[model samples]
Target: MDDPLAWLDDTAQARQAAGLRRVLAPRDVVEPLVDLASNDYLGLARDARVIEGAVVATRTWGAGSTGSRLVTGTTRLHAELEEALAAFVGTAGALVFSSGYTANLGAVTALSGRGAVVVSDVAAHASLVDAARLSRARVVVARCSAPDEVDRHLAAAPETRRLVVTDGVDSVDGGLAPLAALHAVCRARGAVLLVDDAHGLGVRGPGGAGLVAEAGLAGEPDVVTTATLSKSLGSQGGVVLGSAAVIAHLVDAARAFIFDTGLAPGSVGAALTALGVLRDEPERVAALHRAAAAVAASARSAAPELGVADPTAAMVPVVLGEPDLAVAARDACAAAGLRAGCFRPPSVPEGTSRLRLTARADLSADDLALVDRVLGEVLPAVLGRTGVSAG
Candidate 1:
């Protein structure tokens, strides 16, 4: 009999021909390059205090959660992390999930069902897109950053239950969504609002509380926020923060939360510790914003034609508009002793492949200078330009 998976080989061949095949390049425990690719904005992933928190939690709670959260997976550390997150972000309650992706899945699926409508931004993250697909609601795609468009979609929906979902910040370009405007639109329609603050938490808002709080929407009965501990917190997990009723509803109804094992104790402990650090040392948040601005400014100065935008968060993109050029630019960066993330099709819209540079709170002037030096070498080759000086 013919192989049942032969079609997959054909698809792989098609991807390879189109320059879209993806491969993992895992880093060593001790990397030699200056990493501008990771999402660790606070630079706390390697901090001694954070490490100690993880170590103590592992010693006390063991290595694994071992069961779904509804069972034995719920630990004291989990509850502590949830409480700290809710309090930190100014929410009435919080729930922890194994990952940011699962948190989005749980929030979207649990809140919207057969008789509901989910109006999502066109530029939402992949996890949110998948969540919308799984929601079983009539999904409406509205233009990114356009609250008026969202209003029209919500007004036209036949379903009485409406949930408007959006990312607090666009992951690729690092531009903020119009949260207050969207919230107003949702409120006018008596709809619930969910903001995925994956990129906004620990980087935007007061004391790194998140964008929902920054926009003065925190603790609002109609609003809910989801965030990832892996990004700014330098840990691994996700959280959903909202009213007590929403938290209780998710606990009973969210399949992603009910069926998946809870977040590991070490991650929960580390996140809790990270929250304390943020509360005490809020300067780290400001430092991160400055770093992002420096990175974007340097990139723009080197190649004025590249049209790099000022970042509203920790990310800056150098759009190359083709997959091969993006891959080549990334390789050039690697050769210059710097690491940059490459974004191609699906991660970004077609014809907008680019380099994604992230900033860390710990980056110094010398580090920014090094980035300038590396980009000066790489930009000319990718952009076909001359006189792109390092200084």
Candidate 2:
């Protein structure tokens, strides 16, 4: 062993030199700061009903599912959640997984194989990218997020099964995908379409039904959708929705689902209760949009030249060209009693490092003002350091 561990040090140093190293900051269970960093979009994480659902389920089911769903995992509660999700999203069937990542891995790999060609959107979430790579199909990256690129790729592919993969909402820049047009192209090309609606679920569409339902594409025979419960439903699980045939195919072939432990019993109960809450109080969805709109307006007013865009799905990104500057901006926000998401390389492009500001329905007027005040003071400094402005 001639300095075997030295390579790791070298790699770490290189990452540090490029300002791409990451560090974690733990927080209290109850921090006084306003949160614009977490994925709890509808502010349901701490809801009394959601919490009660989790507690009751946990006490009944003993915390975790005993095994994979095929074994000892499936329960009466799981069936209920799946049925509720399918009905909400207008799908004929649904499957629950341990996480969104595994849902993608299972969906993509099970849907497309050696004889199929998978055309993927370049801006898709990393999970979708990984799933595409693992699909064992000839993976082709679309030229852009536009439907034309996907259509062109499918049109040029061989006379084999075709699958088109994209995201409903871009995770970084918060841009929306043209789901309707993309679906049209898929239909014309006789290709199955897969939309990872992780960012769009529980935020977009009527009463938070999701982007697929919003575009009137839900329940389409050739369409499949995946989403996580962690973001909006304020729980931990992933779900796949589509026709019964597709669900059966995944249940039989998706290794990720077959091999991994089932989702926690608590999460399933919380998600089920949260879904009911959303159905009863759909106004939470509207409140979420109002919060996002308020945050976007503040970002614009803070640094017009910084060029922050409107939130497409409850996310506002203020791009800073340098990793170090983005870190500095994050630190400034933290010091100002505001917690925002800081994204660097790998999460975003090299020059597009940014503060990812997420909106929650619970964000009050005072919280919004704090965000506005903090960004007003912080972004200008970021712009100045990057030579976009003078401090």
**Please, what are the lDDT tens digits per residue for candidate 2 over residues 54-96?**
9999999978999999999998999999999999989999999
Kindly give the stretch of ten consecutive residues in candidate 2 with the minimal lDDT sum: 382-391
| Candidate 1 Cα outliers beyond 4 Å, as residue runs | 385-391
Question: What pairs collide in candidate 1?
Answer: none
Residue lDDT tens for model 1, 1-391:
9999999999999998877999978789998788899999999999889989998998999898889998999998898888989999999999999999999999999999889999988988999999999999999999749888988988888888999999998898888988899899999988899999999998999988889999999999999999999999999989999999999999999999999998888998888888888889999999999999989988988777888888889999999878888889999999988899999998998999999999999998888989998887788767773334323
Best candidate per lDDT, number?
Answer: 1
Q: What's the true lDDT of residue 63 in model 2?
A: 89
lDDT of 2 at 383: 77
Model 2 residue runs over 4 Å out of place are none
Whole-model lDDT for model 1 versus the true structure? 0.91
